[model samples]
Target: MDPSFRVLLVCTGNICRSAFAERLGRAWVDETLGEGASRLQLSSAGTRAVVGSGMHPDTALVLAGYGADSGNFRARQLTADHLADADLVLTMTRAHRRDVLSLAPRGLGRTFTLREAGALLDFVDGGSERGEGDHAARARGLVAALAEARSRRPAAGDDDVPDPINQPLETHSEAGQLIVDALLPLLRRLAGAS
Candidate 1:
């Protein structure tokens, strides 16, 4: 059997975005990679909030809309152990990236934001004109550009998947759609990663 590719999806709370990403990413891996899917480990975590609950209602609804099951998901806190074990860590936002890196084990270099990874995949697939050297260098450039762009943006509200801890059900569903949109391509790339 081939070695499993361990992936960790992260967000501020485990109940929403990260959970959606994890489930979708797993399905993508299964569909695209097939037998290789058994060699892939996909999971989600939160920097804070919803540490022990199932996915938020809205997250479930949006995923259900797309025919993805949310039945096996549960919230978990981000931990150093998760970082240590992951071959790749994909976070939702820049803030979530910082939080995960802060807790990441030393010398661990396989972490990135979902957008950043998407950008790198674009670069690799010839969607962008950038020439690649090392994957690390390419990943860093992608992340830096994303962080710079994020700094100049306005804060995202319910449209941004606001924690959803006390928010309305509609909010969680909105957040789930946002997450699914962001995850689709990244999942495709990871599936193609050999």
Candidate 2:
């Protein structure tokens, strides 16, 4: 099926936002796509720090709130191999995007901030009110919407999900909520396509 869609979620440290996003994204894809979810490969990594650790307690807590399973999640570091294999690389912020691009020059076209990608979907869904007529058409529309949003906000930098490591539980909860909100729609679109 179009050569399996591989996605990589990134952040500064793998313990917090990236880990949460990774699990949430994976869950969303699995729930939405069902059997086809096997075709969608998902993983997460850190740009620095947090190379090999379990997800932060707060991250797990926040994910549990959304009914997402974070029990098996673990921290991992970004690698050239990961970059090479990914079809889409979503970073928590613009800085992480840039760092990923530097690591995998070839991924420039596919790499993007989760917020930017989410914004694109927002523009498409918000503008046409299409109500999911045709999957291909809708996908195209989403891409166009993202491009338009991107054009209007050229200075738009990373809307990276803030790191909640060692921060208050409230901060972790807030960060998880933000991630779940952003990922929900994207997951819907991907699942719809499948």
Candidate 3:
């Protein structure tokens, strides 16, 4: 009986970045585990969500470009329950990360900015695609490895996934592109295909 690794993505408004992360993340999880996506659940929430809003139109377009669908996607507010249930909490920005941590101080070791988490993935060794059991072990190891890496590294400048709400479609597109690029490497490692 393997542990279910729950991953929660957080942003200011769930309509744009978080939804996009959720869609992209699920795809990666599927790519990594195929029918075993249940082994690695992916979801999203916002620090200040509109509660029931659909993804931004541009967000949908970007996801569509990546061959992922955003059909009927709705926003949800971040909650302590979400944090308590997660093994990894990836936020769109340091502020979102801070907010999530504020809500659940215990989650500090599990939460990270998407970029930060992915960037740290590059430094961990032995997370290669050896076997399912190995990949799962590596994935869990990677999370803990990241916590250790975070401790030794000096914090950098703000690395936020730009908010696309209330902005122009072009801005949304750019923001979406940014999110995709930032998460690609992290997602690849998570996919266990790297």
Candidate 4:
């Protein structure tokens, strides 16, 4: 059996975007992969973390609205080891991507902004057979496809998931929706969903 595929999500405070992604992504993994969910490992961190802090209240509320929870999450600082261990590094912004690469230059091939990854989905082959029973394989292939697409194309437009901290609930909802917009397609593809 192959080792589990690891994914690291990076953001500024760890209490908002990244934490929401981690929880929502994990929920998707659990729902889609079922018994095979163990093959995927999801985690998150922050470039400027409030170490040991809980998820931002608004972020938690937004996540809860999506049927995911972050009640047990605690903010942690990003480290090179975290980057080294991940098969994919997804950042909330271009600045966070730069921060990740600065710490682990070798991660360049596997790193991309969350919005960028969503946009790159257009570049992956869509006709391949979906391995419904082996999402791990599908996910691995998807990652490779995204990396290749990353090389073939240059970034376009603003790809940031705006920071919603200290903002209104509507702002938080907008941010969460942006995350869902970028992430749900990937999750569906991973699950072989139409």
Candidate 5:
């Protein structure tokens, strides 16, 4: 059996950006990989989460627009265990990435800002639509490939997906769009469909 590849998404409060990305990623996996989606696990948390709180209302609306479920999601605080178990940790911002690393320094190679991962995807060769692997294998390969590619370039100045918790609907939508912009490509690569 292929190993399950775990992905952890992180943000400030886990009510907006990370929450939205988790649902969007799961929906994309289900739609793209069908039963194969079982080989991958996606989860989210926050540096200073509003623990036990539901996703922000604005975030839920953005997800609803994408036809994704926004229910049954309660925010949780980031922990070393979450970092240790993950094969990839995608934070909403560079600061979140640093927070994750501080919790689990060994996760450095596997951690990146969501936008950074998406940008790095363009530099990786193979392991896309023509890749040889199951969903888990593909995801693992994608992480490794991204790690190698990360060192070749300078980190982007605009890698953070801005927080939209207290903002208006439009701001939430923009943040949601930014999350998907970075997330979709990574999901495609994970499913070996890029």
Candidate 6:
């Protein structure tokens, strides 16, 4: 059997965007993959974390409104070691992608913004039966497609997840929705959702 895919999410602070992505990504895995969710391990950290902070209070409110929970998350700083560890580094911004690459040059082919991953997944989805056998195989094809996209001229960076720290309730909620819109569908495909 193939090894589990490790997804490490990165943002400016783990308290907001990355933590939120982790939750939403996990929810998609659970909902779409069911017993296969364990095949994809998700975690998050900050490019410049506060180290021990919890999720922004309003983040919980936003997630709760969407029927999910932050579930006792604590922030951690991104490190070179972590960049080396993840099978894929999903960044909240292009800067975070560069940050991961600077720390671990070998990550160049494996890291992408959530939306960037979406774009590449589209390419793979449009033309492929090689990855049709199983949930994990299709997910692997998607990851391979993302790396292929990174190798080309860096694709445009329009899908950045905005930082919502210290923002109004509406802004926080918007951030949540933006992330969900960008992330959920891609995750569903990874978990073999239709």
Candidate maximizing lDDT: 5
TM-scores of the candidates are: 0.72, 0.82, 0.87, 0.89, 0.92, 0.87
Candidate 2, residue 19: Cα displacement in angstroms equals 0.6
lDDT of each: 0.65, 0.75, 0.79, 0.85, 0.86, 0.78
Candidate 4 stretches greater than 4 Å from native: 127-138, 151-155, 192-194
Tens-digit lDDT track of model 5 for 84-113: 888889999888888898889888788999
TM-score-sorted candidate list, best first: 5, 4, 3, 6, 2, 1
Worst 10 residues of 4 by lDDT: 127-136
lDDT of 6 by residue, 1-194 (tens): 55566789999989988988898788767776677778887899999997988888898788877777898789999988888778778898888888888898877777888778766665555444244555455556667776775555455748788888878988888888888887876666655522
Local error of candidate 3 at 152, Å?
Answer: 3.7
Q: How close is candidate 5 to the true structure, as a TM-score?
A: 0.92
Best by TM-score: 5
Clashing pairs in 4: none
Q: Write the per-residue lDDT of candidate 2 for residues 58-111, one digit (tens) a residue.
A: 888888887788876668789999888776678888889999989998776567
Model 5 score (lDDT): 0.86
lDDT of 2 at 116: 77
Better of 3 and 4 by lDDT: 4
lDDT of 3 by residue, 2-110 (tens): 5566679899879899999898777767876778677677899999998999988888888888888897889999999989888789999898988998999988888
lDDT of 1: 0.65
